[model samples]
Target: MDALIEKLKGQIIEQLNLVEVKPADIKPDAPLFGEGLGLDSIDALELIVLLEKHYGIKIQNPADGKKIFESVRTMAEFIKSNGKD
Candidate 1:
């Protein structure tokens, strides 16, 4: 789980082109939107693509995205449950 979290941080930074952010900057349990990472809807779309492209995981429901993308930890958890490690 720790390895997955670490890999997720790197993938998110690279996929989103977040050059100013590093893996350490992303707290696993911190919210990824609004007050946390300050990500918006566009970033959400990129995240979906990131999941599919990297993890071969497709989000079956759009509503679940709110929960799945709640934080880095949540994303990792979702991937672990629905896709590869």
Candidate 2:
């Protein structure tokens, strides 16, 4: 799980082109949006693409995106639950 979380931080930074962010700067349990990373809807869309492109895990229900993208830990857990990690 820790490995997955670390890998995800790298992916998120790279995919979002967050030049100012580093993998070490992200807290696994920190929220990915709002007061956390300050991500918006567009960043959410990019995250969706990131999941599918990297893990082959697709978000079948758009509503689930809220729960799934809550944080790096959540995303890693989701991938593990789906056997994608």
Candidate 3:
């Protein structure tokens, strides 16, 4: 799980072109949007694509994204539960 979270930080930074954020800078429990990473709607779309392209996990419902993308830990858990990790 820790490994997955670490990998996710790197993937997110690259996918979203967040050159300022390093893997160590993203806390596992920190929010990915709003005040945390300050990611907007477009970043969310990129995250969806990231999951599909890298983990082969497609979010069935758009509403689920809010929960799944709560934090690196949650995203990693979602991928793991979906058998993508």
Backbone clash numbers for all candidates listed: 0, 0, 0
Clash list (residue pairs), candidate 2? none
lDDT order of candidates, top first: 3, 2, 1
lDDT of 1 by residue, 1-84 (tens): 999999999999998888899899999998898785667888998999999999999877877899999999999999889858
Q: What TM-score goes with each of the models?
A: 0.93, 0.95, 0.95
Give the Cα RMSD of candidate 3: 0.8
Who is ahead in TM-score, 1 or 2? 2
Ten residues in sequence with the least summed lDDT for candidate 2: 31-40
Off by over 4 Å in 1: none
Question: Per-residue error at 29 for model 2, in Å?
Answer: 0.5
Evaluated against the true structure, the overall lDDT of model 2 is 0.91
Q: Lowest summed-lDDT stretch of 10 residues in model 1? A: 31-40
- Please provide, for model 3 over 55-75, each residue's C-alpha lDDT reduced to its tens digit, 9 standing for 90 to 100: 988877878899999999999
lDDT value, residue 52 of candidate 2: 98
Cα displacement (Å) at residue 4, model 2 = 0.4
Model 1 scores a C-alpha lDDT of 0.90
